[model samples]
Target: MKTLTVFTPTYNRAYCLEKCYHSLVRQDNEDFIWLIIDDGSTDNTKELVNQWKQEKKIDIKYHWQENQGMHGAHNTAYKLIETELNVCIDSDDYMADGAVERILSYWKKYGNENVSGIAALDATIEHQIIGSKFPEKLNRATLFDLYNKYGVTGDKKLVYRTELTKLYPYPIFQDEKYVGLAYKYYMLDKQYEMLLMNEVLCHVEYLPDGSSLNMYNQYLKNPKGFSFYRKELMKLPFGGKVFKYKQAIHYVSSNLLMKNPKLFIETPKKALTVLAFPLGFLLYVFIIKKTRTEVN
Candidate 1:
């Protein structure tokens, strides 16, 4: 049995999925399985994966489903993964040479029930580390505190215990497909802190069509999901008042985007929601204006 399942949630990314496959096949170690969760791609992704399945260079498991956005695919991935540990590598991204070996070695040295799993590093194809190294002299830190409290920057690789990842599953929103993936991570933060690994585990390439570049469109189109994520953030036990209010502001904006009539009444924290009104309304207006600008 493999120690880790490296899953990629993809939708219509056939053109670049091969890079990920090539990278995985080249891994120095074979202690991990690659799980590809195809999120309703209309392209030739299935055929490509099927072809790779025959190669037998590494373990490849393909599961396809309707276009349920990234969170839905993540949900499916978690449901299917049976490994002790797992990490997500995007369809457009690939792991570094020997990255699997590094992760395995690090976990073998330090991983235990007290910690979730390794929180590793990410680098670009050009070999640039995405963020600062984990806080010096830190043995463990929750995902939220690493960014919010210690001021760690950039996206990092997250390898989690399969059991822990299964506990805080992401919720599916109707008619919307975009939810902040961190909703589950934050929930996990409430329970466990992650072990920081300084080695780069994955290489990232941000495509033009990626979610990072089109967040405004995501906000406009997926207000319900965003609102749901924000509401959940407001309820986290460890985050401070300012952070909760920030979430409240986004929650307000998402509700406004959906034009929900009972926004005030539905808020979990009315005072924060009330205080965030001006900024939230402004954000709603900005999103509308931004969309109009793009259209014109």
Candidate 2:
């Protein structure tokens, strides 16, 4: 059986896909399979992947499907992966040298039914850590602890057991959503803990065109998505003080600030900063406009 399955979900990213493929080709470990979920790209992405497959540089599996956004592609990848461990490498991002070998080694040493997955360091340009640090020793980490205490940020550098991952489907959204099915792993903190590998596994490039970079601006414009996210977050088994704190912040910034500015005028937080930081509501509108122009 394949020990690891690395998949990339991409759309119109043919230009950057080769970088990811090269990273995998250079891996010290070859005990993995590569799967590409092409989300209906008009670009010659299929041809590019085919060339690599024909060369036999790596075992490759390709699936092309109708465009249904990132969540849709992830759902397909989760269903089709047959390896013991699965990790997602974005089309625009690539792994550090020997990252796959290290992951497989850690899995062989520590991975078990009690462990839900593994987390690693994600770095950005100039070698700055963009996301949470992997703890040196394994410990029970709650989703709240993962976010609030450790400051879990980006989505790269996560590997999960194939069986546990297939249980949750990505949530459907009417608008652009911030968190995808990835939150399901956090929800599993109710039952299991993730192993931490203290190494930089992947480098995440922040493009002006990436989905997450502009999401805050969208959140400012359509606070309804924030309401939707909070509602879904409340449904998790770990819903409590920490969740409420984060949800309240999300609600106040998204719904109360933009959707109902009048409420802020009627009743404000006791702390002035709380009321001030969404930028007095008017400034947020200006910021959103500025971001739209810049990102677009």
lDDT tens digits by residue: candidate 2, 1-296: 88899999999999888889998999999999999999889999999999999999889999999777776788899999999999988888988889889999988987789978887778884678876564555454654557656666655477888898887676655554334454666567767877877688887897776777776665654465455555456456665655554554554555553556554443323243254445434445665677778768
**Candidate 1 lDDT tens digits, 1-296:** 88989999999999999999999989989999999999999999999999988978889999999989999999999999999999999999998999888988889999999888878899999999997888778878999999999999999999999998888777788888888999989888887899998889999999999998889999999999999899999988978999998999999999999999999999999999999999999999999999888878
Model 1 residue runs over 4 Å out of place are: none
Q: How close is every model to the real structure, measured as TM-score?
A: 0.98, 0.80
RMSD of 2: 4.8
How far does residue 223 in candidate 2 sit from its true spot (Å)?
A: 6.7
User: What is each predicted model's overall lDDT from 0 to 1?
Assistant: 0.92, 0.73
Q: Give each prediction's root-mean-square deviation over alpha carbons.
A: 0.9, 4.8
lDDT value, residue 94 of candidate 1: 94
Report the C-alpha displacement of residue 129, candidate 2, in angstroms.
3.0
Overall local distance difference test of candidate 1: 0.92
